[model samples]
Target: MTNLKLHIDYPHDIPIDAFQWTPETTLEPFHTHTSLEIGCCISGSGVFYFEQKCYTVRPGDIFIVNQTELHIAQSDEVDPSTFIFINFDPSILLLEDEKLLLPYSYQSEKFQNHIPAETSLACQLQPRIMTIHEELSQQDVGYLSRARSILIDISVLLLRNYIGSISSEQWRRMNHSYRELRQMLEFVHRHFGSNIQLADVAQTVGWSQARTSRLFREYTGKSLRDYLAQLRLSEVKKRLVTTDDLIANICFDCGFQSMASFYRAFHANTGTSPKEYREMNGLSEDFEKLGDANEKSK
Candidate 1:
């Protein structure tokens, strides 16, 4: 399967993005991104694949994916599967309550991605997710605020379910990891454009470099150095879609000190040069409608 790290650019001033997703005729490559995604299967039956596990999904089932897992969903040939996906930055609600992110911070190997339709949580989540899509599409007064409130409520239910499923010892360990993960993510977001190193990140959590790297890789699926590069490349793609900045300038700003290295990484990961990616995804014509950039992925 292909390894594609999807770039999700949240529209300006809007933290949550919700949309209906119907699997296409062609297969979608296994992929992951920094954005936390929750998908509700609305119709038909199909298979959802993670790194090594596959779950059969039916109507009203819920799937949660964090930055750790590489995953995709495919509909059966005879009956198409359709879903509504809610995506947002992990930071969107971090400032409110770090525990709200606990559900998404699950260890991929042990986490349960699919919540069966028969469960109360699954039934509750499906309607709330649809409400999010409606709020986003309508954009009524205080829509975003209402949407975030709904998100928090949804997160709370997820948290309660997760809390009920794990032991107290596991909760204690995950709680510590959650705070550290948020710290690392925030620090990287602030200084990813600079010459930061593993030691610097370790300093944030006051842990040895080795231990820090181990935990980070365990949860994020990449080493700290590689994860930093991943963030840089994501920033590069976002700028390419939304701005008119020169390619070299964008590369350097995102912390790729060497233009050649940036170009090589870009080509290797995306199968397209920066120029081609931009040309295909650029919203230069209608800059204000920046939401168009996300259409490329659909």
Candidate 2:
């Protein structure tokens, strides 16, 4: 089975997405998703549910749900809550500030999910979230970069606000874990489009499979299987736009042996059929044919 998390339909090449959410919004309930999510409550009231606790969300409240946590939300029937949510892969932070990974790597039980209304941190984050929403909606030139920049700013605020909670030893451990994870990711990328098992990854990092699996989730916010599937999905997309190979061929070349499984995984992650995704991001069929004809004339 394809180990895909809920909210698999993140954009190609863009690692972040911001959108409006209401009580009526559809989502897989209590799934441990692969993206770090930060949400700002805009209006009404709601409760965010975790296995052990519930947080009542109100306007100006900022909630952080780390990628590994199983969580869900619902609003009061009388006045449904509305929110602006920004969900992103943690890998995006590596380019800007790898240390920003600190906030999301928090211990779930000790961490405070809800930043209450009156906190200046909440006030600080709301505008940045709004700016991200605008950049995403408008999609102006450099919007992708701009939105990521804003997200980094938000991360900084969160780090500053939560600094007291993280101990010096934990900070040291995070840096060390990041180094180990970097090695593991590089190994996986080198062997992408091949069958990679937990044992394979464990050997690369010189750790037991159990240790590798646990730390991989802590460091990357994804299981080994899901991470590999995502890598294959990314490669499939690159081939889709850059090459005109048959979809089945491209998929099989990427180690997706089953067409049905590959198609389902592609559509689930990209929110488009493979052909549609190609058409949207690459040259049209007529253009391709015209280029081919030009080539023939030569």
Best by TM-score: 2
Compared with the true structure, model 1 gives a TM-score of 0.63
Provide the overall lDDT of each model, using Cα atoms, as 2-decimal numbers: 0.83, 0.82
lDDT (Cα, tens digit) per residue for candidate 1, span 15-104: 469888887646688998867889999898788998888999799999998976899898988888999999886666565577887788
Cα displacement (Å) at residue 138, model 2? 5.1
lDDT of 2 by residue, 186-221 (tens): 778778677778999899878999999987775556
Candidate with top lDDT is 1
Clashing pairs in 1: none
In model 1, which regions exceed 4 Å deviation?
Answer: 180-298
TM-score of each: 0.63, 0.67
Clash-forming residue pairs, model 2: none
User: Candidate 2 regions off by >4 Å?
Assistant: 1-15, 24-32, 46-56, 68-74, 94-98, 135-143, 190-200, 214-226, 232-280, 283-298
